[model samples]
Target: MEAYVVATACTKFEKKPNQTFKGLTEEVYLDLLREAELENGDLIGQAWFGNCGMGTFGQRNIRGQVCFTPLVNKKLFPERVGIINVEGGCATGSMAFHGAWKDVVSGIEDVSLAIGVEKIFQPDRPDMIQEIYDGGIDQFDKDEWIKFYKDVGDQLGKPFNPEEKKGTIFMNTYGLQALWHMKKFGTTQKQIALAASKNHFHGSLNEKAQYQFKVSVEDVLNDREISYPLTRSMCAPIGDGAAAALICSKKGLKLFTKEVQDRAIKIKSSVLTGGKYRTLDEPGLSRIAAQKAFKQADIIQKDIDILEIHDATSFCEIYQLEMLGFCDDGKGGQFVEEGKTSLDGELPVNLSGGLVSKGHPVGATGLSMVHELSVQLKGEGAKRQSKRHKYALAENGGGVIGFEEAACSVIILQSPF
Candidate 1:
């Protein structure tokens, strides 16, 4: 049984409240349930929650129950709603949505709620980086992880390059890959700068985006370089945001109003995949997930009109275009140069500015992607609306162990009848 997203909501990361995690989560849930026309009492099944900075804010394993119970009547629906928490680095939001999708498809629940919330505004930047790097792993060996960076640098013939080491430390790993693409395909720094500039331009039209000012390619290239070949403009800014989606099976779908039913988007497919541990040279999980989604949706590459992908850096968007079968391998840089992925190009990608300008709030990023795509499908993206959109794809990845995604999830969405 295919699942459909009946309602969704996302709060701009920039407007975050200076409250506790529990407080913020309660607000998000209330907004979501109200928007979906779902009373707190109506959610009688399982609840899947995801957050990245819960521990940083002093909330631990019971974060899910604590945040959700306040918005719903726990006394009346205690046993009916089971709470489950998931953490997959940057892909926590997608993981939560995937979990709920599984339960609904398997007939385990008639209705399921997927919510992702995170707050990372702290006093110290290094402390926050360290906390994100550790990310629930038991064998937290910093030296071992640093050595892995050295190994990656060695393989790339850039031994003794401190940028590579630093890249591995902070999601700048895409910089190393970007350098490889530049060396092999003559991909100029200007091309990457163009991608960043376009994202910022798109973000300027999105009210929910963090950085809403337009930037030039020259501005991006001239900006401070976090890692060589990856300017500050290419990196995702730290922020707080929460997104929620209410999904229901066909039987439960009838409860919604005709207006809600008219705007619903069908979940054509949801695919989660991973790669060989500790290696970055292989095909990305996005490729694996897209293949499965396309097969399930009975669509080809050309059938997709719009896409929301994990562009944590300019290089990530380049490589993901190829991995997701939008272009040939090793030619993603060329594809971007040719304007194939632009809003007016053959396939418009990252229509929501992606993580680059939309703000990568870790746990909320994936669901945020879904929220944007669904709006586009419903003709509600407003100024950033696509010219023609029938099917859309959301590709989100999380963490970096050695080279591949520690976890990744992809979902294909289309207008529901």
Candidate 2:
């Protein structure tokens, strides 16, 4: 059986101080059903719910049930739908999406739903934000990472300074990697700023984006420094949001209207790879995932018409451009600097502003990527839609193990048009 995305929806990626997790989930859920022209959730055979911080808020166990059971009791969701909770750090949404795709393709479920919701912003309790990100690293291996950063700093002639660190330690990690790339490939800070500026412009066109204003390259260079070479504008902001995708098999597609089926995108390939502890010379996990995904899809990197990557920082976009083989290693900086990934460039990337400006709600981010690509493929991206819309790719990474992401998922979708 082949799986297709018949419907998708996303809430604005912003901090909703008064919103609860249930509220976010409900918003996207109803919106998705409406998009699919389904009056109720009876057609959903299974569901995968992705979340990260509810555990910190004391909803540690049975998170999916806790959030969905209310709807079931209120007669919104079907009572018998099998709900599974998922977490993979920031890649939680991708993981959930992968699970639903598997359910349909494996002939286990004809229709499956994937939803990711998160509420990480706490205005009165700012420390809670730090606590959420801290969970991305190994808890027992703290000293090991500490020494690893110190060793890398010493090798680069920029000794580690805890006091100089800003945002999460992850920022420090990205800063160190950016610095190393600069030394090795002559990647300039200006190039990184250029990528940030481009995404900001793209964000300005996305009403659903958290930062919906264009930022100049010079402004990005002058923003508040988080870690050396990384400014606030270049980093993904902390926020809360929810997103959902409804996956249906060929047999299940008949349940929806022609309008929904016509716009449905085919899931050509989906690949997830685990992270490993390796040296800087080794390829990142996304590289490995992308290779497998392309091979599975029977398409090369050039076949991708649009892309959404895990751009947690501007440097991440540059690094991912290389890792995904869009450009050769050490040339990602030049690729963006030359406007190859701009909205009107060769390969439009992060037209939804990506994690940097789209707001990294962690759990919802990957599905948010799916939502944007689906919209573009359907020609529904009013302002930011690109001319090319045949194949769309999304690469989402989760956690940080060693010097790279602990888990990464790469998905390729083909346009129904």
**TM-scores, each model vs. reference:** 0.92, 0.98
- Residue-level lDDT tens digits of model 1 in 281-307: 567677888899899888988888898
Clashes of each: 4, 0
Residue 95 CA displacement from its true place in model 1, Å: 0.7
- In candidate 1, position 175 carries an lDDT of 67
Top candidate, metric TM-score: 2
Quote the RMSD, in angstroms, for model 1: 2.6
- The count of backbone overlaps in candidate 2 is 0
Worst lDDT window (10 residues) for model 1? 159-168
RMSD of each: 2.6, 1.0
- Model 1 TM-score is 0.92
Q: What's model 1's lDDT at 350? A: 83
User: lDDT tens digits, residues 256-319, model 2?
Assistant: 8988888889999989999877797788999999999999999999899999989899999999
Count steric clashes of candidate 1: 4
- Model 2, C-alpha of 137: deviation from truth (Å): 0.2
